[model samples]
Target: MLDLARERQGGVSDYRIAQLLGLKPNQISMYRHTAVKPSNPVAIRLAELCDLDPATVVAWVNIERATTPEDRLAWEIILKRLAPQKRLKQAA
Candidate 1:
């Protein structure tokens, strides 16, 4: 999400992203560094900012945070279903 925002036209800083998300700059840094994951609402907001589907973003995050293999598999299936077929093939 941070990368997508930074790569946007004119770009956006971490501080600006934090403001946009109603979070602290350090919190944004934590997310950027993968030290923490954003909450569901925040994830949805990020998906909007990145012009991505909220379900796809949420499923991707759920996959990353899943503690059990079953949960991870479920999220993976959802993500695969949500993603384009061409991208799925390339991801393989």
Candidate 2:
């Protein structure tokens, strides 16, 4: 997610992204390092900053955070249904 943000539309620094997301720079760094997952609102805003679909991004994040098989499956289904066709094609 941060990768996308950094690579898109010229580019953005972690500090700039933090400012845009109303978070601290260390939080963005932690999220980039996989030491922490952004909360849903942060994830959505990050996706928006990256020119991504918030619903798809949130669904993907939920899948990664899911604890049970059923929970994961539900999020996967939602992601599959909500993600753009171009993104689905890229994944395939």
Candidate 3:
């Protein structure tokens, strides 16, 4: 999901994607982390916005929905830790 988000080149920030899809920014954030799936309507909107296949988007959402909360939290922590390193590399 982050891959797709990055591919957008900020075309789909959490707030903007949420607003366009009638979801909350937090929901978009969760989607990025695979913490939760969007609603069917929101999934369709996300596919359109991200230029992804709707079926692929739906599959991703379903996979996210199946993840345990603890795993999601752990993954988020790892991402947070790596984020600065990624930025540093980009800056270099």
Candidate 4:
């Protein structure tokens, strides 16, 4: 389970996970913390990176994919707020 992965990885930052999966950091955080689940493609990537079962990831992904755009946007805002300060250090 992703919750377990979050725990096992010593509270791995969602941004790092996003980087590994080539997604926006906010998207990773949304998948991790919010009720909105990840998409199948995202689940597959997460399973591959986290050494988790694809089925489990698929279930979560299905739920996340079903979320409304408005809900996802809310999660995006929440995830941004929850992000660490260091993540803003990029030389953009």
Candidate 5:
């Protein structure tokens, strides 16, 4: 999700994205880097603003919350959701 955001960010500053999400500029880096999980509202806004698939964005947050690092199951689930999103972005 962070990768997706970065890819789409263009000339938009992290501060601008933070404003869009109603968060601190520093917090944007944390969320973008996945150092912390963003709240549900932020996640929803992120999907809406970036035209991401809601399920895929939420699934990223879910994967971030996994108790285990290197969780293959979580990776598979995320990959499954992302495939269509990737295709759609490419088509656009």
Candidate 6:
């Protein structure tokens, strides 16, 4: 989510994102730095606000939540299953 926000056009500021999430700027900083876990609701809101796939974003959240290598590998496999295509086709 943080990477997506940074890669967005105009590059959304953490302060702006925090304001959008109704959270303190430092909280956003924590999330950015991985000092603490992010709330799923906030992550979903961020994904929606960024016009990203909520399911895909949630999959990423699940990956982040995994504490063990085996668990992370399972989530990675699930994500790969979910995204069998190399890329989404462009609209005509």
Q: How many residue pairs collide in each prediction?
A: 0, 0, 0, 1, 0, 0
The true-versus-predicted C-alpha distance at residue 67 of model 6, in Å, is 0.5
Which residues of candidate 5, in runs, are more than 4 Å off? 6-10, 68-92
Higher-ranked by TM-score: 1 or 3: 1
Specify the poorest-scoring 10-residue window by lDDT in model 1: 1-10
> What Cα-based lDDT does every candidate model obtain?
0.82, 0.84, 0.64, 0.63, 0.73, 0.75
Give the number of the best model, judged by lDDT: 2
Instruction: Write model 5 residue lDDT over 1-92, tens digit each, in one string.
Output: 54455457765777777887788898887865656888767888888777787767777776766667667477667769688878998899
RMSD of each: 4.4, 3.9, 10.2, 13.9, 4.4, 3.1
**Candidate 2 stretches greater than 4 Å from native:** 84-92
TM-score of 4: 0.50
lDDT of 2 at 30: 85
Cα lDDT of model 3 by residue, 1-92, tens digit = 54464457465556765676787777767766765667767777767767766655655565455568776566566546656775786799
lDDT of 4: 0.63
TM-score list, all predictions: 0.80, 0.81, 0.50, 0.50, 0.60, 0.67
Per-residue lDDT tens digits for candidate 4, residues 1-92, read 55555665678776667776788988766765787766678778778777765654565455355458776665555545534432564333
Candidate 1 vs candidate 5, lDDT winner: 1
What shift in Å separates residue 70 of candidate 4 from its native position after superposition? 24
Lowest lDDT sum, 10 consecutive residues, model 6, at 83-92
Q: Candidate 4 at 69: error in angstroms?
A: 21
Residue pairs with clashing backbones, model 4: 37-64
Instruction: State candidate 1's TM-score.
Output: 0.80
**Which pairs of residues clash in candidate 6, taking residues 3 or more apart in a chain or in different chains?**
none
lDDT of 1 by residue, 1-92 (tens): 77896566248788888888888999998887765788889999888888777888899888888989999999999888877854765689
Candidate 3: where are CA atoms >4 Å away?
2-12, 63-92
- Which one wins on TM-score? 2
